[model samples]
Target: MQNPPLNEILIGDCREVMKTLPENYISACITDPPYNYEFIGHKWDNSEIQRRIEKVSGKGNKTLVKNIPYGSGLAGGVRNKKWYQRNRHNILDYEKWCFEWGEQLFRICKPGATVLVFNSTRTVAHVQVSLENAGFYARDMLVYKRSSGIPKGVNIKQQLEKKGYEQPEKWDGWHSCLRNEWEAICVLQKPLSNNYLETLLEYGTGLFYAKEQFGGFQSNILEGIQRDKTEDFNVHCTVKPISLMRKLVEIFVPRLENSILIDPFTGSGTTLLAAKELGINYVGVEIVPDYLEIINKRLDGISGLQGMLPLSE
Candidate 1:
């Protein structure tokens, strides 16, 4: 595996592919990994909670919100002591899984390289902690605000009424959780080589790109990112907005020659396409072959792209 070809999507487990890569070869890592919730039968999301959800949702199609299915850890079940314990154990497993790949990412990233991970708001902290344990320094979290949200939280009032509790009408406005309107983007950087200045000079990393002269000042809060409604939802369950991905690529990946970006879980090749659109080289790994078809179709649809090849700058 002598520097497996760039600007191509590899078909396999990212953890294994990353393990074979040379150390410090990657300039940045941007990925939206499985959120451990058994999201729509993703094989990687094999959590204890998923089994519980299946039992609750049965074999029927669960109610979906936007692209996210509603059959959560509860799928509308009581959060009793046993449930809490099981959920906690699932979270521990999720964190360990994060560390498993985080270590590989840390190994492959150049010193001072950036890593931006998109995760659910509820579990972002666990991912942050896992990355910290994997030797990446925690920086800050970015918020991607959506125009609308999925009200997936269980309705306590409905539950109370079903339980035949007294005066359930009194809790009309009460609910277990708020509407999910945003996602967490964990910002982290590999340990700098000496200092920021030194690292920037040595590896063209350890810094964020502003270029304020060409655009407005950046903010941690990214607002109003919407998906392409025209996208075929059947192709992939969670296809990220191209605008959002391009914004992220522009900021995180430098345009230096041979600079490479890797998205270990390239669900639909959004990051790779975004990198290609910005003239940055990239490599990706996708576990599902069907999704490789989606990635290829999406990449081929690019105005001047062909055969997963990089566009000349």
Candidate 2:
């Protein structure tokens, strides 16, 4: 098959857009999918938690309030009560949902292609099950550790005292949950030929670049600061740092000149930008139009490649 269009962001459902591409065309996939937290509050609504945030952070602190939803007017818990309610389906159902897309990804990827998928710790097991069920072999899990993380949950004793109820003194240290400081990235791969050298020569996959480390040596744990928006690019809420993405891409696509990376859930095109920085080809698909615009604006600032690759008829 002719080379599928590269260095472009297609606006559509990933599953449908992937159908148009040639089979076994993608060399690697690096993506951040939604955690399915079901955040329902609008940006404008000012809840008690927002008011508290404003009070503590002072008024006009746009960074704290922008695009974040505060449910139950309280800070704590991995997700708000509403989020749990919205995603009330059984765990099996959620795994099935993952399978629907994982199956499509498995079909489009080249044999021995590497897949790096970001998932919350809470749901990573389900994602792993789904990917394995879709025929991808589970390789290793990388932990992307961030320096900063929001602490969730409230002090049970303090809440009781505020409500005029007696509580045990030993409960002072108890809380609902611990602060989340890391995200799990599942590394998976398609089946490869028996001979590793032959597989790499035939499919341009089945190998990882260990020498291309971001910090001298590659470890399962990746440490980096979470980067926000800059003057040139609008940042998505859950944007992975460009440095982190670049390192992962380098490891996945060692021969950057010949490989084409694909990001099915390209929120703001960070993976695409990384590919461009490395002078590698890439195709991204974002379901949201607003995010597509943001991606285009981000790509516009990049002078690497011009215009989209024309899709084959």
On the 0 to 100 scale, the lDDT of residue 213 in model 2 is 32
Q: What are the per-residue Cα lDDT tens digits for candidate 2 across 110-190?
A: 888899999878778888889999999999999989787665557888887777876556588888779888989999998
lDDT of 2 at 250: 73
For every model shown, what is its TM-score relative to the native structure?
A: 0.84, 0.79
- Candidate 2 residue-wise lDDT at 205: 82
Model 1 regions more than 4 Å off:
39-76, 159-166, 211-215, 303-313
lDDT value for model 1: 0.78
Query: Residues 1-313, candidate 1, lDDT per residue (tens digit)?
Result: 6656688888887778788888888889899998756433445422433544565475554433223334445344677997687677778888888998899999999999999999888889999999999999998899999888757566888989999999999989887679888999999999999998888777877777766445888888888777876466335556788989988887787777667899999988888888888777888988876677778778776653233323243
User: lDDT of all predictions, in order shown?
Assistant: 0.78, 0.73
* lDDT score at residue 35, model 1, on the 0-100 scale: 79
lDDT minimum window of 10 residues, candidate 1: 304-313
True-structure RMSD, every candidate: 4.8, 6.2
